[model samples]
Target: MHDVVVAGAGPVGLFVACELALSGCSVLVLERDRDPRPPLKALPLGLRGLNAGSAETFYRRGLLEATMQASGAEAQEVGADPEAVEAPGPRALSHFAGMTLNAADVDTAALPYRLPSPAMEGFMTSLDAVTSVLTERASALGVEIVRDAPVTAVSQDDEGTVITAGGRQYRSRWLVGCDGGRSAVRRLAGFAFEGTEPLFTGYVAEVVLADPDQLPIGFHLTDSGMYLRTPFPGHLGLMDFDGGTFDRSQPLTREHLQAVLRRVSGVDVTLDEVRLASSFTDRAMQATTYRMGRVLLAGDAAHIHSPLGGQGLNLGVGDAMNLGWKLAATVRATAPDGLLDTYTTERHPVGAAVLDWSRAQVATMNPGPNAPALRKLVHDLMRTTDGTTQVYRQTSGLFAHYDLGDGSTLVGRSAPDFRFEDGTRLGDLLHNGRGVALDFTEGRALDGTAQRWAGRIAYAAGPVRNNLGFTALLIRPDGVVAWDAAHTPDRHAFERAAHQWFGAPSRLTTGAPSL
Candidate 1:
């Protein structure tokens, strides 16, 4: 039996597969579609932004350059100067309800624990680019990906789960659902999906406009609704306050799109032909819990929200990053007590926050007498330094704080990419998919203490270029700071933290404890 059977072949599922396989767990990925590279995946043609946090995740896996290349992004645009002592202010910015922010307004000094690294700022890329890169990596890691296999039923016992997909039965120790918003696994597994209903129906389409100049480019909020026109020819995004009554299951007729477009844009726009189209609602929902017996959920399967603020892709990526190692450890029989449960405890809040963020934007953009006033106030606020910083913190995919309980300012946050004197970086050390105990003590304070966890954790002793007032720190395989020795190298505290996350150090004979 395989260690894990992952549902969905999208970025999250493939990424989880890669992570499990990296740690020596056999992973089988079942995809619902026959061809993974469907052209429609590139719909909404504009590049999807991978926030700094996601970029760092890619860097940890040594896939940053490949991802950037696939996305047609420049190496210089994706990160800061390698030899710099401090991180630069973010250069990329995200929009809230089509109202964009200026990156220059972000207050860099207010941000904490940021160190100069190759992956600093967010960049624009398509889903196709991301999926292709992950698929190649998953293949190299020996992950089995079977396409045209939609999961039909799921049954689990104390030992493992029997997944019925593609008219075949497969058994695995664990199962992870990374399917999209309408997740079959989620339905079959009987998880509660609860959320607020949408107030409007949103549409994105590529059409043949007879007179494109009739409507100027950029976001236009009308008395009726909101419509956005990108610089790309024929690209259009529309939001109509229809209370989400449009039948999404039915084919998107050109007449209906034109009528909705006219209602929202307040312009008599003519659509000669609609080459492609898709519909969505601001209806945000999330699974009450991520786990059900030996089966679990990740990505959209666990939480789903509108594509507003473009958090869907990034959020799913974060879920995969956080869940991958823990699940791998569980499959290997090396996970600490209750390690698997932490996946939902940590990620659920993040997902909820994103859903609320999306809802907030929708609220502001909702067409009504109060909308103009709301949008004006928000626009004014967003122009300020603090507001810009908050937006950057909210959307950049970095700055997510998982309360690891003790509340050390740095613990539970993404570890800084500490650089060694000889030029090796923490990102370099993390490429092997193992916990890292980076010690900057003069006498190697953590040397012997970290040795007991030898195979489970890689021990590195040296003064980094920027320790950020830390003498030593333990980073989980997912690059999250589990503990840090700020005042002194406290062996006992370090070991306790290690045990909490990495499970009783000592080579963890229970299958190498790769988490």
Candidate 2:
């Protein structure tokens, strides 16, 4: 029996399995898909939050960065490897399309960030690269990933959870459903997913343009649709689509791709090499709950939305990172059972927010009668510096702020990255553990308190960059500051919060001290 059995091997499931295994929990992942494939929805890694910069702190778990680097290297070898003779595809053209990334728009200092050449264009890679790397990592971490296991049923008892597929039953103290939106585990758990269904269908095709120069880095020819031409190691990334009705009964055809490009771009283009194409509908749905008994849900199984901003994969990957630690701590007997509840509280709103934002993005592209006027107004607004900045920030997932409940100063606000007296930045400190409490000002010296909750919390003295007047601050695992007290905090107040947040302040006394 595994400590936790994860259903599905998409980015989320794999990520969660990686985290759990890293945290020293035994994990088993079951995936139905053969592997990642070309024309797969997930595009190149953003590397936006690699350093946990001003973004929502989603991609800071460090696994994606490693995966991205390895993938890029493999792709580079595919294109530059002396043994290979095949030329890269058209997607490679957008490499020098001169893409622009405005740091100021992200509420950060104006600094230039170059999109990697391998990521922009070079070699062609499929989703297999991502899964393969993750699978290898999981295996190294002692995770057992079983493929072709299409789970059909899930049963939970007071003792644990049982999952059955192909007449094989696996039992575990906990069950994690990393499955996709149409999750069988969700159905078996009787969880209700509440949200809107997709009304529009999008057709996507992978092609090698005969003349890649025709494609720009990124351009929206029609307000209702866009023609994004990005470059990969050896090929160009060309995606053009607008909302349309869906007829899944009919296979997507090359003629349909030509018609859409012609109608939207007003250009008749022939496909140099039509590698892969498919039609997909967008839906905005989130589970009513994240857990049932010993069973838990993460990633697409918990929430799903339109891929307007390429947030589907990012969000799923973030979900895994968020849940992995909390669940590991609980199973390891370090965290209180109530700690698991915070996962839903913190992530549910995030999922809902994604749906809301992605819905608006899709709405802007709705090709209705009002589309022309709406498009004009949007264009006029976006032309402004302020509007352009706002749109850029919002669409890039840099402005998502979680409401950690109204309590004290900076409870919910994302903690501003600050420098410590020792010259350490908050982002630098987060690499160690969940959150830290830094008391630059003279607060109640957590003398015995330091020994109390050692592993879970840390206290250090430093000069905060913001000068927000908060002497003491409580940070969350995701690097968001939950509570800040400019003045010395009351010992009782801090203890009460510690009890509530981590559960059982008394445990701190008996547990091992944190680093």
Candidate 3:
């Protein structure tokens, strides 16, 4: 029996499986799709953005370079100098209701604790690029992936979960549903999915335009709806304020797509052929909770929203990153009390925020007299330095803060990549998928105390290129800082923080001293 059975071989499930297998948990991934490399996941139509947050996650896992190369990202565009001490200003930013923000306008000095790293900006990548990199990593970590195995039934008891897939049954200690919005595991497991309905039906397609010149490129917001034409040939996106009543199950033909294009774009554009097409709505919904006994949900299984703000993929990546390590610890029976529960508590809010962000984008672009005024106001505001910075924080996939209940705001945030005098960075330490104890104290103050956690936490101490005023920090496996010290490091407080997150420390190999 596997330690974990993950549904869907998409990025999230594969990532979670990789995290588990990396930490010594046996993982089996079941994918419903037969083809490993689906055609739609290639190039133009399949293109997606990997926000800086997702970029950081790939960096933490040592997959950033490969994924970047595969996605054709230039080194300098998404990277920073290795010897630098400060993080570069935002290199890229997303849009709000088709209104783009200029990254140059962001006030970088206002953002604190950011240090230089190779991955400082969001990387534009495709689903295939991401999955290829993750699949290779998952394979290296000994994760077994079974294709064409759709999870049809799920049953769980106090001991383990039974998953019926591909006409067979498998037993596992835990089950994670990483499937898409129409997740079978979530439905079969009976998790409550609740959220606001959609406002419009959105269409994305690759078509052979007979009169392409009639429609210009880039985001075009009309009185009817919004339509985006990418620089890539034949790529088109449409947001029709049709109350999301279009039956998405129907195949999108040339006739139907041309009508949508004409109505939304207000251009008499003719489509000769529709190569590939898919429809979505801003229908936002999230599982009430992320876990149900032995069965847990991650990625789209947990929450789903429109791609307008381009937060869907990034949010799923965040879910995998947040849940992977905790679920691994739970499978190993090394988790602290209520560690798994924190996944829902922490990620649910982030998901909800993304959903609302999507809904707001729809409202801002909806066909109404107030929309033009709202667009004008939002456009003017987004052109400001402060507005650009706020938008960057909201959409860059960085700056995710969990309320760890610590009074200090620094504790619950993502740790900056602290560079040691020896040239190692925090991202380098996290490549092994273990929590790290970074002690900037000159005398190795945390060296002795950190050993109590031993294999559960890796310890590093020394002078850093820039400590950002932190003397020491305890970072969770997911790179969230559980504790930090501004003054001389305290052993008791460090121990308490470690215990709170990593459970009780093990007896020191040199023989644990009596408390």
The candidate maximizing TM-score is 3
* Tens-place lDDT digits, model 3, residues 322-382: 9999999998888999999999999999999998888888888888878888989888988
- For each candidate, the alpha-carbon lDDT, in order, equals 0.87, 0.60, 0.89
Clash totals for all models, in order? 0, 25, 0
TM-scores of all models?
0.96, 0.78, 0.97
Better of 1 and 3 by lDDT: 3
Give the poorly placed runs of model 1, Cα more than 4 Å off. 43-46, 507-515
Error of 1 at 68 (Å): 0.6
lDDT of 1 at 292: 94
Q: Per-residue CA lDDT of candidate 1, range 242-342, in tens?
A: 88888395679999999999988888999999998888888899999999999889998988787887898889999998999998888777789999999
C-alpha displacement of 239 in model 1, angstroms? Answer: 0.9
Regions more than 4 Å wrong, model 2: 36-68, 71-137, 210-217, 223-225, 232-248, 333-337, 383-389, 392-399, 421-425, 442-444, 462-468, 506-515
Per residue, candidate 2 scores C-alpha lDDT tens digits across 1-515 of 78899998876788788778866888888877654442353444221121112122322343434555654643342112222222122121111011233333332222121111111222222345656667777788888878778889889898888899756899998999988888988989899998886756655556666665555555454643555554542132222333335436466666666666656555566665666666666678899889888999998899887656556665775577678878888877777658888788878888887788777766666666887777667656555556545654444333345565665546765565545545555555565445566666533355456446666666656454445566666776666666666666655666655655555543445332222
Error of 2 at 257 (Å): 2.9
User: What are the RMSD figures for all models against the true structure?
Assistant: 2.8, 8.1, 2.3
